[model samples]
Target: MTLQKVNLQEKFNLFQEQWRPKIVGELNGQHVKLAKLQGPFVWHHHENEDELFLVVKGRLCMELQGQEPIWLEPGEFLVVPRGVEHRPVADEEVHLLLFEPAGTLNTGNVQGERTVENLERI
Candidate 1:
């Protein structure tokens, strides 16, 4: 293993696509990912792994089934519990930091257009 700094600004600059998550770091059995999101995402749930989303820039809305959407701004985070159906919607471009198990799929159990089975590290 080697020690190197992971600069968010530099990492974020590596991509421009929306809803695609890029790996930035790994800890324990989890992956620390960065993503740029815009528009609405599919409503799905992780059957086994909990997902964490931290807004880095702009704003995001976490919409859970049967519940009011939770709004998150920069520095705010939300942990979507395993098996809870939810979707993320961003009116504008949003920068986010995501933490989840290494093999956790971006689309959770549902396979759709936004599903990412393999994510590249930046």
Candidate 2:
């Protein structure tokens, strides 16, 4: 098997659309995804999957139900456990790296226009 290093900036430059997650790597039934985020996202929760959000650029405010917002800066990360309703809000364009189980939906329990059923591999 051949192994290659993935460049995060190069992969991020391949897409400009916000809220769309592009797969960059996979391991142990999990996917490493990259996305550009702005504005607020839907409030949702995963039934059985935990999500890890790593801020690559800008800032991210993770809003949990009935809780104070958790701020994440560049090089910081947060893991939202399964069954916890949460939302991500960005005041400006933020580059993010997400680690989640394979086939995990971006919108989780709530599905609507923002749901990305098929993710593109970069």
Question: Where is model 1 more than 4 Å wrong at Cα?
Answer: none
Residue range 29-90, candidate 2, lDDT tens digits: 99999999999999999999999999999999999998999999999999999999999999
Query: Using TM-score as the measure, which candidate wins?
Result: 2
Give the local distance difference test score of model 1.
0.95
Question: Where in model 2 is the C-alpha error above 4 Å?
Answer: none
Candidate 1: RMSD to truth: 0.8
Cα deviation at 78, candidate 2, in Å, is 0.2
Reference-based lDDT, each prediction = 0.95, 0.98
Residue 57 shift from truth in candidate 2, angstroms:
0.3
Clashing pairs in 1: none
Candidate 2, residue 7: lDDT:
91
Scored by lDDT, the top model is 2
